[model samples]
Target: MSGGSKLWGGRFQKPTHELVDQLNASLPFDRRLARHDILGSLAHVTMLARQGIVPLEDARAIAQGLRVILQEIQEERFVFRLADEDIHLSVERRLRELIGPAAGRLHTARSRNDQVALDFRLWMREAILEVGEGIVETSQALLDLANEHRDVVLPGYTHLQRAQPLLLAHHLHAYVAMLARDLARLQELYRRVNRSPLGSGALAGVPYPIDRAFVAELLAMDGILENSIDAVSARDFALEFLADLAIVMAHLSRLAEELVLWSSSEFGFIEFDDAFATGSSIMPQKKNPDVAELLRGKSGRVFGHLMGLLTVVKGLPLAYNKDLQEDKEGVFDALDTVALLLRVLPPMLRTLRIDRGRMHTAAEQGFTLATDVADALVRAGVPFRDAHEAVGRLVAYCIAEGKTFGELAADELVRFHPRLAEIVFPRTVWDAVRAREHPGGTGPEHVARALEASRSELERTARWLQQERQRIDEAFARLLSEEFP
Candidate 1:
């Protein structure tokens, strides 16, 4: 069946072409916004009734009709068809069918243009919250794991070469810092995405005195969007969101890349818990870090989405163009990608079995104490450049002799520079790792403090999320009671 569209059909004498219908239909992807559409419509209709633009009885009917549609959609009993085109039209069509002519008043002071902007904004608000929670979840895991491994020393790397001995906790908390910054980005996005675009009425401001502010309040938005054209046109919010997500995915990819590297036999720093690892069909002994690899690969996909959206919205004169329809699919995919990645990573990390021996063994072999030796030279009144060069020679000599730092005694170390013998030197990787005990250093004490701070931050974030979600929920409850009660 063609499921002929009537919403925009009045001027067209004939039905839309079959190919055009299939090609242009957004219902397949945008039906996910049905709930958000109804929510926006209810707030809009309620405001219309309050403004006396739509009669109170009609407003009630529209609200009731929308709620009924919401229930049907929720129950999957409502039939979605190609003709409905998008959630706005699908919802309006159903509302009209249920309440006769009064439901036609539902679009009283709005256009699908501003309505969808409102819906997208509402969806983005919830998404930011959900993604924030995922970030917290992942950060909490990192914190707990860091706390658990505070005493374990691992080799820190630069250019994929071991550079220094660091506490495992410090290695883990680096990701916590990245996530903290990403959360800040999300906070700003949440603020930006919470502004209401309702009453913008296609491209221009609505007539008949639509209560944009009241609608904003009912929808829990921060305020009305100041420019009606910009309100419906700009998708910088989505760009910012995807940009933030790209960075987020980059962080995750970096971490997942580490997990993949760490679990490899060449590194042997950690072993994945078998449940999270995949086995190769051909190689009986092969245990693959597929989860981490996939997470890393998925980063590119998210980055592409960000760039794709950026490409889509460029050079467009829009107070709502068809190109804007390209927005939701990328967002939906990126949201699912980040959320699912977060869901798997925390547990994958928790189940990981760290090879303390392998880590320490590797930490010792990399001449990881070069910085410590340099610092000792600096303490002996050598300038840092000279000290760095002196340590560089010592490291080269050790490598040439097939000797590690531990094999070099203090008396032999003095061969590099006579000032080195009078100054402190780290005799072992453990000593080198512990020597930098300053605040924020990778020293055990510093890591313990950082882990505590991370735990505290996670707790505060949890409380904030709970409170914010409660306010949003209460807004929904109040809106529901007024219309449905």
Candidate 2:
């Protein structure tokens, strides 16, 4: 069977094949842009009327019709037709039905090329802020956890072997630092995504006296995309978003990996809340850290989306292509996945029980205080390299005799270096941690200051999100108002 495209069949003598319709239609996925499409159209139609390209009365009618459609979609009353091909046409077809011929004038100075580009950028502008909020929430959660466990010390590892002792607060602060960078990346990317491309038309600039700047203002965009061709063609904003999302997932996956390890029977440093853990069907005693495992596993999923978009975009020709349609779903999924992780992770972290005794014991078991002992020798006028070599031999001697440094007699210690007989070794984990009182160190006073600074940073990011959200909401509220001139 063959049929003409309901919205674009004027020149076709014969209709498209049914198979082509299924292959060509983007209504299923691109329909996610319905709200964004209406919002963009509202701005475009208002601009058209101001420039005298569309009659004022007709612009008012089109704006009314778009508001109705927006409400329909919001309330789940709108129908999506595959024959309409995409969100742009679906809204157009419905607008025509609602207000007759005036709806047609709404698109007078725009084409689906620039229209979709506008909708996508609008969508991303909102999404970037939303992701920023998530990052803030996650960072705040980590900071809260660090504050709650400020006195605990744990073995910090390199190459999976315990190498040094650190405050657990310092370890959690590392993730907070990574998330702050993720938030910064989104804030930077927002500037690029905030430009309007609506008046670019198909490829070359529209012939009408369209005011791109006014449309951008109406939509709360920062400015117009300067080049008409680039306006409809550029997708680097989305690529950058995906790239930032991949980094976010990488940070989250690291935290999740640590959670999984810490909750295990062998490590026993923490326990997941029952709500965040799962029980096995066959194993009677298996309480699995499934949520953490899933969080860790989903990082690759986001990474794959980033790679997929890059590959799709690498060889694209100038202007627009149907190939550009491949961009949305990956972005949608990646954002949704990151949002879900942020929502669940904070609660999971807040509920987990920390075994401070286990962490402190582990901190002491790994010869973690050796560096502090070597430093003590350096303070006694022994060269650092000599101090390190002497400490290394002392460790070997303790291992051979099946004794710890605390168990070594003064006679035994003096065999390595005469100064070792007089040096008071740091046998407790607190001794090692308290010795590092410099800024950004694992010392109690420094961790306390860092926690306060991190909390302040998180508060600033939250305020930024709230203000940006208000700006966008006010723009849409004005666009949806009944009084359109």
Candidate 3:
């Protein structure tokens, strides 16, 4: 047995079994955090030098070595080994190669526990912003589609049955609204994820004269994680991220479901572009909406990750356990899945052809105007429940007579209730949709205003993304440059 691969093997007399090494190694997946690990180490060493815990020359050496490792990783030249266990060790091992023993002093005031926590938080901060940007782009795509088809009418459903007429824009806006909440969740969680977890050494505060606030500021984080124990052990930020991603996936899945249904011959409300659709291996006539189906199907994987992390953390005693190693793969995978979903869905929606005539015709065929007719009855001085019942009977009579609401004459309508004759029913799908003029309604004007509001909201979110990204970029650039306090 050999202990050469283990960084913390100083006290152990013999190395663990090879199977244990393979079981415990995280470098395979966690190499994704290599850049973040280097960034965190840079901040830590800079702070250590500034606080006089380590000499400025040694700090410069470590910083220079880390920058080299970062460049190698960025250029695809950095070698990662499973024996190094995880990103922290992989980078440290490489840092040793580049700068010798000065790399050893780099870990002076921090534990791998706090170090890993800080690295994950830093990575998640960038990820939340990236996911937010993806949300913005996706929202923009939906808005563009809405703006283009603001007047196109479709049947809105309740319990998978047509219930009312809605603008296509209004329908697309529903997803934009859902994604807005998803973006808001990421923004809110960003605050929690942005706090620094460095200086909380191994679940306890370090005794050295380290400046946690300086380190946090250097990394452009919001603040330190105040509680040392929580700083190292808390995986709540990851959990929140996964939960938010699951919601985003749910929204995408719903939209994907509609796309699937609409593209089907039974609905024929939309058609996917050839680029977005896949053909059956044996059935040449079939052009499948595989992207949409995938969007719907992959949601479960993200949901499972959220639940998996919840279960992983549910039984753990706080303050950093080996079990916490289970956190990154799920988070990394969920983020990738969500990012891919956001990336593909917008284009899938944008390129697809909508059958406006088909949607309007379908909208007209369903008794979507039943509610409007009921409301008209109430306006004509009928009591609400009586009006509902009267409309119910009218629908039944139409169904029995092989008639539609529009096919019934005034006398025929009056047979249900004399007052119904006094109220003119909405004559067309547009009339049914335009009847809803209130704020947030399906009316054209309301949807137009909603699109404008979404555009403005998108602009605000875009500005925020730019500012936040710039702040982090500048802070990181300064950390690498020759300028030092």
Best by lDDT: 2
- Writing each residue's lDDT as its tens digit, candidate 3 over 1-485 gives 01234457668777878998998888899898888888888888888888889999998888888888899999999888888888888898898998898889988998888888888988998999989999999999999999998879999998999989999999999999998899889899999899998988987789999888988998999998889998888898999999999999999899999999999999999999999999999999999999999999999999999999999999988767888889989999999999888888788778979899999998988688898889887887788899999989989998899998877888898898988767787878888888888998998998899999989999999999999999999998988786643
Tens-digit lDDT track of model 2 for 1-485 = 01246456677777778888888788899898898999888888888888888989899999999999999999999998898888888898999999998777877988889999999999999999988988888888889899999999999999988888999999999999899999999999999999998888888988889899998998999999999989998899999999999999999999999999999999999999999999999998999999999999999999999999999999988878888888899999999999999999989999989999999999998688888889999999999999999999998998888888898899999999999999886888898898889987889999999999989988998998899999999998999888664
The 0-to-1 C-alpha lDDT of every candidate, in the order given, reads 0.86, 0.90, 0.88
The sequence of per-residue lDDT tens digits that candidate 1 reaches over residues 1-485 is 11344446666678777787777788999899888888888888788878889888888888888889989998999999787777778888888899998877887777778888888888888888888899999999998788877778878999999998888989999999999999989988888898998888888787777778998898788898899999989999999999999999999999999999999989998999998999999999999999999999999999999999999999788567887889889999999999999899889989989999999888887788889889988887899999999889999999899997767777878888888767868888789877778987887887788888877887888787788788888888777765532
Q: What lDDT does candidate 1 reach at residue 420?
A: 73
TM-score per candidate, chains pooled: 0.96, 0.97, 0.97
- Candidate 3 deviant stretches above 4 angstroms: 1-6
The order by descending TM-score is 2, 3, 1
450 in model 2: Cα distance from truth in Å? 0.5
How many pairs of residues in model 3 come into backbone collision? Answer: 0
Worst 10 residues of 3 by lDDT: 1-10
Provide the lDDT at 445 for model 3.
Answer: 90
Candidate 1 residue 400 Cα shift, in angstroms, is 2.7
Better of 1 and 2 by lDDT: 2
